[model samples]
Target: MDALEILFTASFWVAAIRIASPLIFATMGELICERAGVLNLGIEGIMTAGAFAGWFTVYAGGDLWTGVLVAALAGAMFGLLHATLTVPLGLSQHVVGIGVTLLATSLTYFIYRLALPEVTSPPKIEPFQPLPIPGLSKVPVLGEALFSQTPLTYLAFLTVAVVAWVLYRTPVGLAVRAAGENPSAVEAQGISVTAIRMGAVMVGSALMAVGGAFLTMSAFNSFFFEMINGRGWICIALVVFGSWRPGKALIGAILFAAFDAYQVRLQQMSGGIVPYQVFLMMPYALSILALILVARRATYPKALMIPYQKGER
Candidate 1:
């Protein structure tokens, strides 16, 4: 293909991966948590909290890496809060998640307002540069498109593979699945369902936080108000679309991103065949379709969304 054709064809795919990265990471996190019997609606809130923490870290120290670390730590703290309220207190998961979301959003906005005090000089940082693979960059059409991406981009793919293995190929994976499907049965076998679920939430929250941090520290280098923009809900959709499987969910996340990326391209195209707002709705629309497919499959975990009491079935 000619250079112009290559650029036109590759642009959408590149944008797709870029858009999909955060969702991929966050959905994987949600998969872990849900597979442990917790439907964490607080993902949106957790992401917002991470965005603020990462932005603040960069603003204070002028280092993106530091911001990432701080964001992960903040996420873990949120996860702990989630576990405490839902696991021990036995609060309703939906209510607790919404509360966490509200708290995180309020806290983020409050801290951002306090730090800047004015929008005239909002804090910003330099985004991470993409690193092209050696020799691979010279390949025909695929080189620049695939081999040239940020470190985190590669890490996102690796996470999918690793999570898939840990969730399906190991003993710990079996235990987590058992705990989610039938916590009472797992507990009868001497496994601590509470501990397993707690671990899942903590790890999942950390991943979600990094997904938020990626927006500030890598994608844009500056945080804006409500930067996450419903990406968390998208993650939940991806988990359902993937049937709670890590690898399949990653593909679904990429497909969702592709829809988003295609919309941007459509806006730039000459004829303007598709309305901007309609294009923007594509991801959510696709997610709704996915939800329908899940309903048909009926593959949800038996114990999903149920609060486990210590001695109850």
Candidate 2:
């Protein structure tokens, strides 16, 4: 298919949506952290850890959903460590975040080596299967792209809706936002900024782990090193691309995914004519362009990445 023709194809969009699924989860996770005034640079390692944790759980005889839960718990533990250092201790968020990433990544690799001692190949698990919605899956390209995905993909979409609701429609959301924007005001309201920021980080990390689990449990049935492949970092940029909003972040994920899907197809169409690296870089290049456009007008939270100490203004 030609470049333009591919855009109109159902299969193209199906691939795009599938590619976007994990990204949506991670982007939402980052959005939550940033919204509550934390910068989680540990996402790459957290995703790596989650990918291993979830797949290993299932490989060791746990159910699929249970695997997902274990991954979230694992992510939360790391998130807790990050929060303790950054929130209460008021350490450099950048340094601590990078430290958390290294620690989580190293620890996960150690566990993997210890668990699989003699296995040459990564073990496999029965991953989640697609469940097409009865009426909606029949609605042309949109149906196949949106409604005919694994349950986790649906959950990713639901997460965006839930995040938007919580951030804009609920009181707890207000507190979270306030903690990021004006901690002193939140303190005046008798709320604990520490608690809110820490909670946000933990919850956000949980979702990021789930995103990693999706790589193992849905996109592929086995866990492998480097499988996450910088998707977590891409999610960070996606949060900025979406202006820290769930819906916009969702779009950013899909747009990036579309670029990715298109690139693969373009590679096929080029056969041996063009260098493969050019095609591989297409999605990221496009995403950077998109981020540049969106970030200019993006009004970030006032206290994002600023350590908030209660009663100290």
Candidate 3:
């Protein structure tokens, strides 16, 4: 193939990685939390909160890194709320998640309106550029495809590796898995299931926040209403689709992202032959399909969607 043809094809794969980065992070976060026996349906809300927090930080003269920090903080706060409701109070996880989603959406819209009065021409920030590795960028097509990616993409891969290590090779990971499976037994052993669960939830929330921050600071560089859309929810579905395993969830997240990436390409190729609305529904459609697959497989967390009572533990 010609050099330009090679570049074009390589760029397509790179674009898919860029598009999938946020999903990968969020999915991995959800996987960890779920593995701890906590179902964080509020991932969507946490992500939305992060998106606005990150965007406003940038709008207010902060750098991209600062925005990301704020986003992680926002996510942690939301996670705290979720943890309080479902952990100590013993409220239904489903209710808490739905409440978080509603609250986050309303809060984001309210702040966005109050902060940006002029909708006609909103200000935008510059996004992160791809940072190539020192030596990896020169190895032909695969090199550019793998190394020529934004910092967040590199972070995503690093996150997966770290999480995999922690999940499979660490002492704390054992506690987390045990907490999810048999809380009372874990508590009897004095390991503090509640503490482990709380820690997991907060960590997961921070990761989800970064995922949202990436959408604004690195992926799009601008925030619109409901900027996260339903990406967070997709991550939640991915937990089940991936059977609550971090590695599997990462794969599922990437697969979903690939479907989305290809859907866009298909729409462009159709040249309006297929309605744009139809193309827009692809992610949701695939999400539903994933849910169906999950139902058929029945591989969700054994204790997912259940509130954990302190005494019960």
Candidate 4:
């Protein structure tokens, strides 16, 4: 099929949505951290650790859901470490974040080596399968794309909705927002800014881990090094692209995913006429262009990356 015609195909959209699932989860995680005035640079490492954690759990004979839970717990622990150093002790966010990433990645790799001492090929697991909604899956391209996906994909979309609701409609959301915008104001209201920011980071990190888990548990049946392939960094960019809103971030994730899905098809159609590298770069280039256009007008939280102490306002 031609390039233009591919956009309308159900298969193309199904691929796009499938690709978008993990991004949705990670982007929401970053959004939460930033909303609460924390810039988590450890996302890449956190995701890596999570990918291994989940895959390893399932490989070791645990259920898929258990693997996901283990991944979340792993991420939360790292988040706690980050929050303790940055929020309470008032360290540099950039340094600490990078350190966390390095630490997590190295630790995960070490664990993998120790566990699979002599294995060359990674083991595989039975991953989640797609489940079509009875009535909705019959509705053409949209239905097949949206309604027929693995349970994890459904959860990813649900996470966006839940994040939006919590951010815009709940009292806890108000405090989190305030912590980012003006921690002193939050303190004035008798809320512990430390607790709010730390909690947000831990929860956000957990989601990020789950996003990584999605990779090994849903997108593929086996684990490998670098499988995350900088998706965590892309998710950070997506958070900014969406201006830290869950709904807009969801759209951005889908848009990027579509570009990715389209590029692969284009490569097939090119029949080696075009360099594969160009096709591989298409999604990132497009995403950068999109980010530039949207981020200029994006209103970031005033206190993002600024460490917050309890008092001394």
Error of 1 at 42 (Å): 0.3
Q: Quick one: how many clashes does candidate 3 have? A: 0
Better of 2 and 4 by lDDT: 4
Off by over 4 Å in 2: none
Task: Report the lDDT tens digits of candidate 3 across residue range 1-313.
Answer: 4423432576666777887899888888788788888888888878888877887898899987898889888888888888778876778888887898788778877888888878775578887888998899777666876798888889998999899889779988877887787777777787877788888888888889889888888888788776787898888888788877777877887777767777777777778977999989989888888889778876655665566666763
Cα lDDT of model 1 by residue, 126-243, tens digit: 7777888998855744566566778777778888998899989997888889878999988898988889888888888888988888788777878887789899998998998899
45-92 in candidate 2: lDDT tens per residue?
999999899999999999999999999999999999999999999899
TM-score of each: 0.93, 0.98, 0.92, 0.98
Clashes of each: 0, 0, 0, 0
List where candidate 3 sits over 4 angstroms from the true fold. Answer: 1-8, 311-313
Better of 1 and 3 by TM-score: 1
User: Scored by CA lDDT, what does every candidate get?
Assistant: 0.82, 0.91, 0.81, 0.92
Q: For each candidate in turn, give its C-alpha RMSD to the true structure in angstroms.
A: 2.4, 1.0, 2.7, 1.0
Q: Which model, 2 or 3, shows the larger TM-score?
A: 2
lDDT of 3: 0.81
Encode model 4's per-residue lDDT on 120-146: one tens digit a residue.
998899998998999998889999899
Model 4 misses residue 29 by how many Å? 0.3
